[model samples]
Target: MVTAKVETAGPLILVVGDVMIDRYIFGDTTRISPEAPVPVVRAGAEEIRAGGAANVAANVAALGVACRLLTICGDDGAAVELNGLMARQGVTLDCVTDKGQRTTEKIRLISGVQQIARIDHDCTVTDAARATLAARFEALLDGVGAVIFSDYAKGVLTALPELLAIAAQRGVATFVDPKPVDPARYRGAFLLKPNMAEFQALFGSCPPDRIVDRARSALDEMGLDHMLITRGAKGILLVSRDGEVVDRPTQALEVFDVTGAGDTIIAALVVGLVQGLSMATAIDQANIAASIAVSRRGTYVVTRGDLDERLYRREHFMTKLVPLAMLCDRIARARETGARVVFTNGCFDVLHAGHVRLLAEAKRQGDILIVGLNSDASVRRLKGAPRPVNALADRAEVISGLAAVDHVVVFEDDTPLALIQALRPDVLVKGGDYTPDSIVGADVVRQSGGRVMTVPLLPGRSTTATLGALGR
Candidate 1:
């Protein structure tokens, strides 16, 4: 689970291709319409999001990187809406408006999580518009670290050959999320990313085991340096001109919607490359970002905070079991990163459903959860002799393994007052029938402008009751 730190001060990223507005009309469908056989949707809310190349720029900005989008749109209402959305996301828009064209827009009517119907309005770019876009691309390619061509085959990317040639002359790396157009159009690109279906459409299908060989051959024919084929469930396959092949499995735990996943991947990959990460490491980060995007319902912009939490949980689980001093240091670092700290304490002698529920509730209160486990000596002083069947190390290990618990530290005192005073967590939590005033660290947490919460314990589930039932 080794990962690289993404530098926010990396060079600027330029995105050029088709830009469109994705409009979602959400509502409820209770009965069929009297007018027709279709379900009648009682529209409730409307959402407008950036799609196509504009979405790539949004994802890059969300990752704390500088990005600029270059595309052509119609002088219509959709163009105005696109401007406001991109401005809010911190993306610089360099758009050319053509009076004869109608900006591309996809209107999707959604009932609950299911999409009922979609309406599309689009227009192709004129030859004059392509000339203006080409000039803009050349001017913007001077200081760009990388360029992403997000082609939706809407006539915006018909001049890809000239654009790729200009980027190559300027020594700027270019990546392409290509549509199923002529293979020669993508020639000389640094990297080409196409889903499994697009890959088969452009360059006929072959046996699963021979994808790498076929990808390498395509690279040679297209004069490409590298190719990344994204297989939805099968994950991503990377093939280089030098015969280097790397296969990575999908990281998504659940699939909700895959919209804008390709935009997320290209955005993450180019950002990683600009931040000085290896190609393989960049692909790994892209996979993680794509996984986060698919778990969401629509065009989700994966933020830097989201990426940090996912990476931390994936790679730093074993490091969670630390001493009190190290735990304090980690809390300080977490605070610096704008993460809230949560604190809870207990003997946790026997792990049970009640304990799990309590911990999960505590985690919901804050970003980072720190469990204060009573030391062996402290447990004996509090629960009497022959109690705490699990040792301190064993207890910490088990708690740290749980997803709800971020870090575990053993406390020697009878109560966690000393630990609380030292850490000064943003939230203090306890399980049982206790008021905020009665909690041990309530005063300390309150003085620091923090809240104290209590979660009700599950009945008939306690270590003492289980020990008694076992006749111990």
Candidate 2:
């Protein structure tokens, strides 16, 4: 398996599989019923999302990779909604139809932060439908960078071996999500990914001696090049004949629903590999992709922007500091993601002990703290005669360099009104000398329902005293 970051990365993956609808019934369970063992739920909201193969396509699309879907669905209401979801996702739906088969759907009954139960509706495809779907699959594979067979065994991949042969002869990189692993269903595949249960179930009786070896031999005999065993929470294991079996652990802090996680991993791996990433890099990318999937509430797919944002947020924050105007835009983005805002202002001339304490306290009031530094001219106007002990740009940049300050905006004219008007902070703070009611911008914030707090200036720790001590 490839170890880490590969030079080449990302590819167009064609996903062919079963399309299932994942429905969530969300509500509260208040009363214990005498009628049965289950608690009676007061239903609140019901949401439906794309699941199964459709979810994999969503994941591929979400990661900004090009993908196409080749599958079958019943001509019904679910199909209509599924098509809408696919169209919105920018994934091509070359999905064929079996007139009588019902599109698969998994209805999940959920209570606040918990799943009460899930019910599945699925059916096998008839021979005539399978032939038609196979023809459609072949026609759709012309320009695919990599091919993924997301066989949920929900009838999309009934003639598995023949499909594998077709995928192989075309030299398309393939990843097969094998289910009900009978070995016969997976023969001649390029890569086989079976969860531990499916792995053991298919080869359980063969030999207890070399469980992994036997599994590898079986895959090798079937003409498969690689095998990935997904051990939930233990992470993923990759087996390639040319290299070692590397086990990458599950990085999930908590697991909500296992639904659609595997689909995300294989889709990511296929994209990474076809895009020229090393195997290790591809799997790591897959691991990162899967880690993101399990944390989400439902079977909804994770978008590329989601993964990129998750991976790049810290870097983005460190590199994307902006001027005051642009800073408001950044702060707006932070608030949209639920970060609170704290504001404090000062000349901060000589970086006094009182300044540090005030900034730290301001930071404690909210998730992100913005320091409004008085411009040199503003400080001179406020303090009278050669006032600002430091230049405005230097002072503002120094205040921004602080660990406690999330951002810094400079204001002229002795007051922070303009900057305050821009940020509309959740909390505004000032030295204890003034009443919270009288602090500048206090009325603007209070009238807007934001809080205003007056903090005590640390005794004898003023910037003037520090400068006096420094000169001495």
Candidate 3:
């Protein structure tokens, strides 16, 4: 599974839903009594944190995503606190209102050691709040990479159909962490994430073995591409056309409160997918996130420091996942000392021994060999109507791992002229009988007082040869 790599989460996320404030009342419990079976408590310090949609945004920001919040709040002190919370977390509040509606607030009463009860207060001005949030949503939809509907069923996500329709029209993926009370509201979302209890509440209880099947059928019936049912103690189940279920027996930890576990899962999943994680990998990260959430005292924000601490403690579990950018730079520097800068541009539609020998010879040239790769679009543009030996990412990854290669950078244009100009290699090498002038970066290298040369072409080793031989 692809673990979190710091720089992988720059994707823009537009979050629209119920934004609320969490007010925690803390006190000491010394004696039980006067009241029937209740302990007499001495009041202590109070605390306030972002809750509901605000909480989700906090989680998103914690993961280093550029998050924008769109929701309604009342012209009250709660709004003041919510605004302050967003600024501190580095999340921008775009769609907001200070109308007659009271901002949604979840007030919790806790004794020194445990939570006793919680109360929720908010504006019921559904019409005004809905209109304000929708206007902001429409305005923010133009450039956002993905949309998240934090449907707490608190009236903010009441207009779920419109939200889904808008995102669909824009070709943007939508993720919804919904309330079980109204499954119909979240239909047609790109993906829906619900905890086990919520899933059972909406789809009815099922034998543990058949739970995934039931969810798949329900997701299809609702027209969703997929569904991720978060099993609190059993782990996470991924349901889709390409289905996968990964189990995580609850991590060994003392459970404090599962207050914002759902919010935590949705936040982590959105960030992972934005950073390009596969469904299964994203689920692992989310499960890790939820594990940390449940271990905390209340609805707490998970920080990078906390994750690093986990990584240090659990060294056997995670390898040193260097960031991709860092890997490229490091390889480039190492090659400068003795490697030859043999570069070849191609769809590399396929990898073969010919390709390997070409790369190896390129490496044998001087100090470092850098390959300028054609992006999927660029490959399709140059290779013909329909051709890319492999997807761009897979191709780059495969090339980067080769022992003879130093770095592989993708360029979407028809040629790697710009990349050549940027890297400015000492020597430019290409395989096959093509002259130096035929190479895209030849001009740049020559202008920079560098040399360009063509390596001997290998016979019967071309991608075309392999494809025709295999009748591909």
Candidate 4:
């Protein structure tokens, strides 16, 4: 429960657990093998990548955060490849090489978007090796912002309690990507991220309705701060100790290979937490990152540039039309981040430069801008017949596509008074034509102790003028 924020130059993260090498042989499967009852995958290209905990570290480093990976591996050629991959990703490794142990490696034969077969090589460490790893882990925890345990049922994290104690002593956050063996060993962790199957396996199966209650009970029993249940297609569900349950739905993606999606989640989530982002915002970022990871083949690492482009596409353009209930839910989450909300409403039948200027100026007044769009029926009633050149859906889409607009809520009322009363935004903005007292929702905003302001509209730029010129 460390509330004080710890700032660092690199937002340094330390990952300790199992390390492995993932090799992929890609080609076409055209014929069946006569020798065996299987399709022959004619290998065309070969690729190597860091897997397991090492993949997590690669993701963290790729996102612009300096990462240090600590793990136990054997002195084999596979170990050399894993080390080389980690080094190329700019990850500093503190590896404990054991000559007697076997280096973990997984080779997959992929043919036309399908994994034909996989071969795995893994080994466990001896008691003496585990002791040596613990010593190295203790030395690496100094000045670290966060620690991630990427357990793969390997012996690297046998001393979980001691690891948690050391991280707690230093006031550093600790997160776990838990293995299926023993859930009790993960107690006292700041956050536990277990996928759906793993979560159900650790805790007995419960009905969907009772998941939150059962999860709360487990959190209290384990003394954990939070548990993030990652559902593959359903997205992530975060349950906090204070009985807060937040659900972030997955973004639409054409998933090619689901391998390493969990690793991307852990890397992006920990970075967001250490960077002081609210849980909601951090989860949003992680969801976006995971969406990108699943679209690629094999174990892929998501970079900061990829996230930046995705976020820009999400926020800057695209009409974000949401129902009233969903809008209120989003507003509540935004409020938790101490963001000031600015509300504005208009028909915006045909977009023009004046409307763009007004919306952009309104955005400058607050952290988030919510535009209340008048429905087609409401517009026809207010402006009479032959009005509303466009439908509600089209207008809402156009308004939402702007970079300045964060949310668009279509209302059927002539005035936005009822909607304003419900939202109670921090600031109510209007175009320059209206004075503060003349605004429709000014009184409702004032009664709520909110401010009312007007942004100057661009001269000689109006949708009405454009329509009039067309008639002339």
| Best candidate, TM-score | 1
Q: How many times do residue backbones clash in model 3?
A: 8
Using lDDT as the measure, which candidate wins?
1
Q: In candidate 4, which residue pairs clash?
A: none
What is the Cα-based TM-score of model 3?
0.63
The TM-score, computed over Cα atoms with residue i paired to residue i, of candidate 2 is 0.71
What's the lDDT of the predicted structure labeled candidate 3? 0.75
- How do all the candidates rank in terms of lDDT, highest first? 1, 4, 2, 3
TM-score leaderboard ranking = 1, 2, 4, 3
How would you encode candidate 2's per-residue C-alpha lDDT over 1-472 as one tens digit per residue? 2121222443567888888888889999998889888889898888888888899898888777778998889877888889998998898888777787788889899988888888998866778888998887777766667778888878778887788778777777678887765888887677888887788887665443465586667666776778888878878888776545767887665677677888888888877776667778778888877887888688847765545544542344432124575577667767875888998887888887778888888889999888887777888888877777677756766776678987666677568988888889999998887898778898888777799997888899887787678789
The 10-residue segment of model 4 with minimum total lDDT is 2-11
- Residue pairs in clash, model 1: none
Give a tens-digit lDDT track for model 1, residues 1-472.
Answer: 1122333555788999999999999999999999999999999999999999999999999887889999999989999999999999999999999877889999999999999999999967899999999998998876688889999988888899999999888888889999955798898899999999899988889999889889989988988888999999989899999778879999997899999999999999888888888889989999999998999888888877667666755764433566676567667766975899999999999998999999999999999999988999999999999977998767877898799998887788999999999999999999877888899989999999999999998999998888888895
Two-way lDDT contest, 1 vs 2, winner: 1
How good is model 1 by TM-score? 0.80
RMSD of each: 5.8, 7.5, 16.9, 14.4
Using all chains and alpha carbons, the TM-scores for the candidates as numbered come to 0.80, 0.71, 0.63, 0.68
Instruction: Give Cα-based local distance difference scores for all models.
Output: 0.88, 0.77, 0.75, 0.86
- Taking the tens digit of each residue's C-alpha lDDT, what string does model 4 give over 1-472? 7531446555789999988899999999989989989999888989899999999999999888889998989888988888899989999998988878888899999888889899998876877877888888888877788999998986778888888888888788889998855877888899999998888888878988888888898899998999999998999999999877989889745788889999999999998877788887888989999998999888989887667656755764445766676677667756875889999999999899899989999999899899999888899998888989998767877887788998888899889988888898999999989999999888888888899998887898887898999899
Sliding window of 10 residues with minimal summed lDDT for model 1: 1-10
Model 3 residue pairs with clashes: 338-366, 338-367, 339-366, 339-367, 339-368, 340-366, 340-367, 349-389
Q: Per-residue error at 380 for model 2, in Å? A: 20
